[model samples]
Target: MSLRDRLFGRERRSAQTARKRLQLVLIHDRAGLSPGTLDALKDDLVAAISRHVDIDASGVHVTLRSDRDKQRLVADIPLAPSRERRRELG
Candidate 1:
Protein backbone atom coordinates (compact mmCIF):
# COMPACT_ATOMS: atom_id res chain seq x y z
CA MET A 1 0.00 0.00 0.00
CA SER A 2 1.13 3.53 -0.62
CA LEU A 3 2.07 5.69 2.39
CA ARG A 4 -0.92 7.87 1.67
CA ASP A 5 -3.32 4.90 1.69
CA ARG A 6 -1.86 3.67 4.96
CA LEU A 7 -2.12 7.06 6.60
CA PHE A 8 -5.71 7.40 5.43
CA GLY A 9 -6.54 3.98 7.00
CA ARG A 10 -7.63 2.42 3.75
CA GLU A 11 -8.26 -0.93 5.49
CA ARG A 12 -5.18 -2.78 6.66
CA ARG A 13 -4.80 -6.24 5.11
CA SER A 14 -5.10 -8.07 8.44
CA ALA A 15 -8.30 -6.27 9.40
CA GLN A 16 -9.85 -6.92 6.01
CA THR A 17 -9.03 -10.64 6.14
CA ALA A 18 -10.40 -11.01 9.63
CA ARG A 19 -13.61 -9.25 8.72
CA LYS A 20 -14.13 -11.63 5.79
CA ARG A 21 -13.49 -14.69 7.93
CA LEU A 22 -15.83 -13.51 10.65
CA GLN A 23 -18.62 -12.86 8.19
CA LEU A 24 -18.32 -16.30 6.61
CA VAL A 25 -18.23 -17.98 9.98
CA LEU A 26 -21.43 -16.29 10.96
CA ILE A 27 -23.32 -17.40 7.86
CA HIS A 28 -22.07 -20.96 7.94
CA ASP A 29 -22.86 -21.21 11.61
CA ARG A 30 -26.43 -20.27 10.86
CA ALA A 31 -27.47 -21.27 7.34
CA GLY A 32 -25.43 -24.45 7.08
CA LEU A 33 -25.26 -24.42 3.29
CA SER A 34 -23.60 -27.38 1.70
CA PRO A 35 -20.07 -27.01 0.38
CA GLY A 36 -21.09 -27.38 -3.27
CA THR A 37 -23.84 -24.80 -2.96
CA LEU A 38 -21.58 -22.44 -1.11
CA ASP A 39 -18.96 -22.65 -3.78
CA ALA A 40 -21.48 -21.94 -6.50
CA LEU A 41 -22.84 -19.02 -4.55
CA LYS A 42 -19.40 -17.55 -4.12
CA ASP A 43 -18.68 -17.84 -7.81
CA ASP A 44 -21.99 -16.21 -8.71
CA LEU A 45 -21.38 -13.49 -6.20
CA VAL A 46 -17.95 -12.71 -7.62
CA ALA A 47 -19.42 -12.61 -11.10
CA ALA A 48 -22.15 -10.24 -9.96
CA ILE A 49 -19.84 -7.93 -8.09
CA SER A 50 -17.34 -7.84 -10.91
CA ARG A 51 -19.98 -6.50 -13.24
CA HIS A 52 -20.03 -3.30 -11.19
CA VAL A 53 -16.41 -2.85 -10.15
CA ASP A 54 -12.96 -4.14 -10.83
CA ILE A 55 -11.80 -6.69 -8.23
CA ASP A 56 -8.71 -8.68 -7.40
CA ALA A 57 -9.66 -12.14 -8.61
CA SER A 58 -7.13 -14.04 -6.53
CA GLY A 59 -8.05 -12.14 -3.40
CA VAL A 60 -11.77 -12.72 -3.46
CA HIS A 61 -13.05 -14.40 -0.32
CA VAL A 62 -16.66 -15.30 0.38
CA THR A 63 -17.96 -16.98 3.50
CA LEU A 64 -20.75 -17.22 6.02
CA ARG A 65 -20.31 -16.43 9.71
CA SER A 66 -22.32 -16.42 12.90
CA ASP A 67 -22.27 -14.51 16.17
CA ARG A 68 -24.65 -15.62 18.92
CA ASP A 69 -28.15 -15.43 17.45
CA LYS A 70 -27.08 -13.46 14.43
CA GLN A 71 -25.60 -14.67 11.17
CA ARG A 72 -24.53 -13.03 7.91
CA LEU A 73 -22.78 -13.66 4.63
CA VAL A 74 -19.47 -11.94 4.12
CA ALA A 75 -17.67 -11.38 0.87
CA ASP A 76 -14.20 -9.87 0.85
CA ILE A 77 -13.65 -8.55 -2.64
CA PRO A 78 -10.49 -6.53 -3.00
CA LEU A 79 -11.29 -3.85 -5.53
CA ALA A 80 -9.16 -2.15 -8.12
CA PRO A 81 -9.37 1.54 -7.38
CA SER A 82 -11.48 3.79 -9.58
CA ARG A 83 -12.20 1.11 -12.12
CA GLU A 84 -15.42 -0.44 -13.37
CA ARG A 85 -15.30 -3.89 -14.87
CA ARG A 86 -17.96 -4.68 -17.41
CA ARG A 87 -18.11 -8.37 -16.60
CA GLU A 88 -16.47 -11.09 -14.57
CA LEU A 89 -14.57 -13.91 -16.16
CA GLY A 90 -16.08 -17.21 -15.13
Candidate 2:
Protein backbone atom coordinates (compact mmCIF):
# COMPACT_ATOMS: atom_id res chain seq x y z
CA MET A 1 0.00 0.00 0.00
CA SER A 2 0.95 3.67 -0.36
CA LEU A 3 2.36 5.83 2.50
CA ARG A 4 -0.96 7.62 3.00
CA ASP A 5 -2.86 4.34 3.16
CA ARG A 6 -0.35 2.91 5.66
CA LEU A 7 -0.55 6.01 7.85
CA PHE A 8 -4.36 5.95 7.77
CA GLY A 9 -4.37 2.30 8.77
CA ARG A 10 -2.20 3.05 11.81
CA GLU A 11 -3.66 6.19 13.32
CA ARG A 12 -1.75 6.17 16.61
CA ARG A 13 1.70 5.86 15.03
CA SER A 14 0.88 8.56 12.49
CA ALA A 15 -0.44 10.90 15.13
CA GLN A 16 2.52 10.31 17.44
CA THR A 17 5.04 10.96 14.66
CA ALA A 18 3.21 14.13 13.61
CA ARG A 19 3.13 15.48 17.15
CA LYS A 20 6.80 14.64 17.74
CA ARG A 21 7.92 16.28 14.50
CA LEU A 22 5.75 19.35 15.08
CA GLN A 23 7.19 19.88 18.54
CA LEU A 24 10.75 19.33 17.28
CA VAL A 25 10.35 21.72 14.34
CA LEU A 26 8.61 24.38 16.44
CA ILE A 27 11.35 24.20 19.11
CA HIS A 28 14.07 24.42 16.45
CA ASP A 29 12.43 27.42 14.78
CA ARG A 30 11.63 29.18 18.04
CA ALA A 31 15.02 28.84 19.72
CA GLY A 32 17.17 28.23 16.63
CA LEU A 33 18.21 24.99 18.29
CA SER A 34 18.48 21.77 16.34
CA PRO A 35 17.93 18.40 18.06
CA GLY A 36 21.69 17.91 18.47
CA THR A 37 22.23 21.48 19.70
CA LEU A 38 19.31 21.26 22.07
CA ASP A 39 20.74 18.06 23.57
CA ALA A 40 24.10 19.72 24.15
CA LEU A 41 22.42 22.78 25.64
CA LYS A 42 20.31 20.63 27.94
CA ASP A 43 23.43 18.86 29.26
CA ASP A 44 25.24 22.14 29.80
CA LEU A 45 22.24 23.74 31.46
CA VAL A 46 21.85 20.94 33.99
CA ALA A 47 25.54 20.95 34.81
CA ALA A 48 25.81 24.74 35.09
CA ILE A 49 22.75 25.19 37.28
CA SER A 50 23.71 22.32 39.58
CA ARG A 51 26.75 24.31 40.69
CA HIS A 52 24.51 26.90 42.41
CA VAL A 53 21.22 25.29 43.30
CA ASP A 54 19.91 21.82 44.02
CA ILE A 55 17.59 20.82 41.21
CA ASP A 56 15.26 17.93 40.58
CA ALA A 57 17.54 17.22 37.63
CA SER A 58 15.56 14.23 36.45
CA GLY A 59 12.33 16.23 36.26
CA VAL A 60 13.82 19.43 34.84
CA HIS A 61 12.13 20.60 31.66
CA VAL A 62 13.89 22.69 29.05
CA THR A 63 12.00 23.92 26.04
CA LEU A 64 11.69 26.76 23.60
CA ARG A 65 8.81 29.16 24.27
CA SER A 66 7.39 31.63 21.80
CA ASP A 67 4.91 34.45 22.35
CA ARG A 68 4.00 36.93 19.63
CA ASP A 69 7.39 37.83 18.07
CA LYS A 70 9.44 36.89 21.09
CA GLN A 71 11.27 33.59 21.58
CA ARG A 72 12.94 32.43 24.79
CA LEU A 73 14.54 29.32 26.24
CA VAL A 74 12.18 28.36 29.03
CA ALA A 75 13.75 26.16 31.66
CA ASP A 76 11.23 24.79 34.12
CA ILE A 77 13.93 23.49 36.44
CA PRO A 78 12.26 22.19 39.58
CA LEU A 79 14.21 22.85 42.77
CA ALA A 80 13.68 22.70 46.51
CA PRO A 81 13.90 26.21 47.94
CA SER A 82 16.25 25.88 50.93
CA ARG A 83 13.82 23.95 53.19
CA GLU A 84 10.23 23.24 52.16
CA ARG A 85 8.85 21.66 49.01
CA ARG A 86 6.86 23.72 46.47
CA ARG A 87 3.45 22.25 47.36
CA GLU A 88 4.04 23.09 51.03
CA LEU A 89 5.76 26.47 50.58
CA GLY A 90 3.41 27.79 47.92
**What does candidate 1 score in Cα RMSD to the true structure?**
11.4
Candidate 1: tens digits of C-alpha lDDT, residues 1-90: 888988998857887899887776656656978557788988898888889877787788876666687666778888875523334431
With a 3 Å backbone cut-off (N, CA, C), the pairs that clash in candidate 2 are none
Worst 10 residues of 1 by lDDT: 81-90
State the weakest 10-residue window (summed lDDT) of model 2: 80-89
lDDT of 2 at 35: 65
Q: Write the per-residue lDDT of candidate 2 for residues 1-90, one digit (tens) a residue.
A: 579867788545677889988976886876768867777888899999999998778887777776677778888888846655755777
Residue ranges of candidate 2 with Cα displaced over 4 Å: 1-27, 80-90
Candidate 1 achieves a global lDDT of 0.75
Give the lDDT of residue 61 in candidate 2: 76
